[model samples]
Target: MMQSTTGELSLSWSQVAARRLVRHGLDTPAQGARPAEIVRALCGAHAQVVSAAFWSIGLRSASLTSTAVKDALWSEHSLIKTFGPRGTVHLLAAQDLPLWAGALSALPPSHNGQSQEVRLTPEQTDEVVKVIAAALSDTELTIDELSEAVIAATGSWAGELVMPAFNGMWPRWRMALAQAGICGALCFGPNRGSKVTYTNPRRFLPEFAPVEERRALTWLLKSYLSAYGPATPQHFAQWLNAPRSWAKELFNALSAELEPVKVNGSLAWVVAGDSTFPSSLPQSVRLLPYFDAYAVGGQPRELLFPGRATQRALTPSGQAGNYQVLLVDGIVAGVWHQRRSGRRLDITVEAFEQLSATQRRELDEQVERIGAFLNAQPCLTLGPVNVGAHA
Candidate 1:
């Protein structure tokens, strides 16, 4: 019998995380992946990966074919459930959607510190879905058009509806439709001149077949642990917006296949039954997109930022500062910001505290690589912090 050890794992943490992120189309390498290769790998099939990746990698928005988004829908694997985590639209993968939907749905109306007056009724939801479905039966309908159709369907019932009274109702509609196996964004017409159109999942990809909900949930939980294990139940619960009981259940299911490791004096889970060292673990710098999971996934800032400095890096409003990070040795050593003028991209480094000569050199090399990644020439500027510095 063989035991699993961290060193035996053939891949480094950065490589595994990066590869998984890129494979899911959440992060695009400076060198892009081939479209055929991407399709073959089943990239973009998971909605959480897509949404979280989009935020993590700082993509303005993924320019996906409407069809790909649709394939994720209609298959019954994913759903757009209301009152889900963050009270926003998330393209949750099929398997995890039910658990998330169920957990969120079970919460009281005032959960997440939100008001209850804005909640939607089943009848009102049905009316909106019916009208929107009918109006968009043949073509893509924009947000305005969908809203109009929804309002029209209500007719005399419109004034009595809670959705119409609230501005946040659109996301509720989106969530409901997602639960029904419809996913994808409203297509914006060229020149921003035409009305938005609703792109149906069936119309986008004709091959999607609904999968069993239990299987989908199990697979999603497994993927979460595999990619982000060594995490605590609280962390998992937070990320999935699930209850402690639900998260515990899922986490226990994989206990036999996961090993516990100590990270910063705390227990974290890691994949079990594998023994291979990763090919390489290079020190690379990346400008993570806002809302990146590396920053959001775990509960405390110690994983990515120093505990003492977390307050300064993350504002009271929960927004990360403007500085691009220096990911030296897989730990955030300091912050960097770019100033672009004409063909020049000047990068300024702000060390967390102070750097040794060796650390400084490492930082420089990492910045150089970052320059190349951005397709710009590197001009390094080093100095002490100013009272109010602007990047």
Candidate 2:
């Protein structure tokens, strides 16, 4: 019998989470997709819009049109907005939104009262609703069109213009739509300036049904733990951008289903009842897009990549940038990007550090798989290794 190496024996918490995502069909190797495979992997039986979006990007590395992304949103999932831990736009399922929002709401704003002032108030929000209803009821509007209508409805209140002004606007709109019980996106054809139309959530997904708020929250928490567990309250809190108290409460409620594992001396939650590790791992390469959930969703991403390498992957402002990640043996080994010149796809691979001869051969083989997935020929350009070296 072949013995498992110490590295394999001492599985990192990140690998544990990645394995669960794959088993649940939430993630796939970088080998591309067909539309049907995409739908089947994501929709499963639950059939939520968000899961579809997650499935699409996780498997294909493609960003669906707003409509495609929104088609996954459902009222059974709660959507709310508050500056989460990393202070970014995150569209969560409705049932999961309240506790997440409630947790964040309880925290002091990072910038004192000034930051809070920028958020919409109940009255102002009511006006926003009226405008959105009026504009979207009859026709679909682009983000710009919706922004104009909101400005008109609220007499140009700062909140109406807020969505367009901040980079965080999309998540805010998702929150608004979830609150209104109007899930789904108004996708545009070609460009934002082109024709746009509203789509019904039910029409896109017939199986989803709205559930009670409390029940939704419970289900949402379970789903998060199921897909992203082997994590801690801090990881949960960070992922939702909520408070420690809320994270603790959810973890406490989920105690029966979660197994505590000692990782690097810290306790992390793993899915209860599962003891087997994945027997066969994919031998393909993946190019994860910027802001990919796998990188951002995990708390202390060092579990995925080294600290110095992680910093280089993100923007100077600490935001995820548009970088293509290179995955080998189911872990992030390096980063890659493509320069397109009409018909040719010029690929560059930047290793976190020097690759062993075996790793290099594996990378070359994996790149071929990537080429097959994209249906294009790849011209490989190797960049300097930066894993262990200072930048």
Predictions in order: lDDT: 0.45, 0.48
Looking at model 1, residue 14 earns an lDDT score of: 51
Write down the worst ten-residue block by lDDT for model 1: 182-191
Across 276-333, the per-residue lDDT of candidate 2 in tens digits comes to 5554554444555445555555455665656555665655544332344665554566
- On TM-score, the leading prediction is 2
Model 1, span 45-108: residue lDDT tens: 2223333332232221223333333333333323321123434334444333334434444333
Output the TM-score of candidate 1.
0.61
Question: Which candidate number has the best lDDT?
Answer: 2
